[model samples]
Target: MRKIERSRMMPIALYRYNLALPLAPFQWNMSQNHDFIQSAQRTISLERDSVDALLPRIGADFTLACELLLNCKGRVVVVGMGKSGHIGRKIAATLASTGTPSFFVHPAEASHGDMGMITKDDLVLALSNSGSTAEIVTLLPLIKRLGITLVSMTGNPESPLAKAAAVNLDASVEHEACSLNLAPTSSTTVSLVLGDALAIALLEARGFTAEDFAFSHPGGALGRRLLLKVENVMHVGEELPQVSPGTSLSGALLEMTRKGLGMTIILGDDGRLAGVFTDGDLRRTLDKGLDVRQVTIDQVMTVHGKTVRPDMLAAEALKIMDDHKINVLVVVDGNDRPVGVLHVHDLTRAGVI
Candidate 1:
C-alpha cells in the first residue's frame, strides 16, 4: 500500500466513500445547500424592492391616518388577524413607547366579546394585506356601529376593510417575496416599515424628549443615566471625606482612607470648601520633602477643585469627571459647602457610567 499525504488528498473520495451514511434520506449534499441560499437571497431582494415601492405611496391618506391617531383623545386600538396580527402587536408597542397610547386586539378575540375594549373615542387601526381577512371584516360593522374612527392599512385600496375606514393608507407591494408568491413576506415587511414611519412621525410631532422616554424606561441604562441625580448616588455625612484647613496632613489622609475615596475636602474656618487634598497632591508634597506630621492640609491642597451641585444629574457629573480626567467630584451647596462626595465607582455601581 502506498501512503497518501493529507494535503494532496481529494475530499471527493472521502465524501463519496468514508462519509457516506447508511441512511440515504439523511445524506449530506452541497447542491441543495447552494439552492437554499440562492432562494433566500432572492426572497430578501424582492422584499427590499417591495419596501422601496412603498416610499412613493405616502401621501394625503397617510397624513390623514397620522392626524387621526395623533388627535385621538383615547388610545389607538390596533386590530388584525393572523400574520398581520403579529405585526400589529409590535406596532402597538412602538406607538405606546414613543408617546402615543396604543395596544393590540386580535380580530378573533374581538369577535368573542373583546369588542367591548373598543370605544367611540378609540381609533381602530386595522391591518390586512388582502384587505378582506374574514375575521377582521367581521368586526368592521361593529367598529363603525360603535362610532369608532377606523383607519385601515391594506394592499388593495378597494378592499372592504379599506372602504369602511375613515382613512385608507395604501401598504401595497408589487409582489410577494416567496418563490411561490403565496406567503406574506414582502407585504408584511411593507406594513411593518409603514408602521415604524407612522410611529416616528408622531413621536417627533409630539415633542417627545429624552426625559419623557426615560420615564417610560426607568429600568434601562439610558433611563438610569438620565433620571438619576447626584443626590441619589453621592456619599453623604460620614461617608464624605472632609478635613478642616488647619487639620494635619496625616488627619486628612486618615479621612481619605476611612472613606476610601482617595481624597478629602478641605474646609475653611467658615465651614465652606477651601480646597481639596488628593493622593496626587500628597505625592507632590512628599517629593518636595515636606514632613507629613508637621504640614497642614491647606499647605498642599488644590484650591477651587471641580465640584457639582447635589441636584445635578449623575450623567452630568460623569461628563465633568471624564472631561477633567479625574475620578471624583464634591457635591456642594449654593454656599460652596461640601454636602456629598461622588466617585467614579459610585457612578459605576449606579449603572450611570
Candidate 2:
C-alpha cells in the first residue's frame, strides 16, 4: 500500500515539472520576439531624430557648399572610406545625373595611383563622419598641392579635414542607431540627405530640364519617354492606311489589312483628315447589319478622331490614347492633314511605353 502511494505521487510531481519546463521556453520566445521588434522600432526612431537634427544646421554652410558645387568649372570628385565610400558613390551618381558632373574615387585607391584622375579644374568632395579618416586625410596635402577646391562633409566640424576645406558642410549626429552606439547609422543618413539637398539646389540653379536629364540617361525608360517624338515612332508614307471617305467599307478594311495598323484614316478629296475607321468601328457597323460591300466608310467612320502633333512627345501621345481609350492616333500637320499613323504598338517597339 505504501509503495503504491509513493508511485502515484511521483507521477504527479513529474507531470508538474514537464508543464513548468514548456512555460519557461514559451515565455523566453515571446520575450525574444518582443526585443527584436523593439530594437527595430528604436533604431528607426533614432535615425529619424538624427535626420531631423540636420535642418537647423543647413544654413550658411549649406548655401556655401551648393554655391561651390554650382560654380565648379569641372567635375566634382568624391572620396570616402568604408561605409562612407558606399554613400559617396551614390551621391556622386545622383549629382552626375542631375546636371552636375561628378564621380567617386575610393580614397585608398586615390592614395595609390588614382590621384591622377583629379585635376586643378576638379573640386574634391571628401566624406568622413569623424573628419579624420586616415586614407582620406592622407590625400588632402596632394589635393591642396594641385590647387583643387575642397568641400568636406564631416561630423566633426573642427577636425583637420573640415578646417582644410573651402567649405565644411556639418554632418554631425548625436549618436548612432546601433545599440552599442558605434556602427554608423544616423550619421550616414544625414550625410546622404545633405548630399541630395546640395545636388538639387545646383540642379535648380542650373535650370536643368527634363530633356537635359534625358540626355544624361539615354538608355533608361524615362529617357526614352522624354526624348522620343511622335514622328520617330509613327507609321509614315506607304505604311499609313488611308482611304477616301466615299470608299466602301470593304475597301477601307483592305487598306487597314495592307498597312496592318488595325485602322484606316478617311481623307477628303483635298487630302484633309475627315474621319477614321478602326476594328472597333467595323464591329459596330456589323452589329448594325450594315453591308461591308455597300456601306461607305463615311457612314460608319468616327469623325475627327483623336489626333497628335508630329513633334509631340511619344509619351504625351500615349497619355492622350490612355485618356481617350484609344489604340491609335493620327499624326497631323499644321493644316490638320494626316501625315502619319501612330499605333500603340509603335510606342511599345520604341520603348516609349
Model 2, 68-181: lDDT tens per residue? 898889999999999899989999999999999999999999988999998899999999999999999999899889999999999999999999999999999999999898
Each candidate structure's TM-score, on Cα atoms with residue i matched to residue i, is: 0.88, 0.88
For model 1, the stretches where C-alpha displacement exceeds 4 angstroms are 1-33
- lDDT on C-alpha atoms for all candidate structures: 0.90, 0.91
Clashes of 1: 0
Q: Over the full model, what C-alpha lDDT does candidate 1 score relative to the true structure?
A: 0.90
Cα error of candidate 2 at position 123, Å: 0.7
Locate the minimum summed-lDDT window of 10 residues in model 2.
1-10
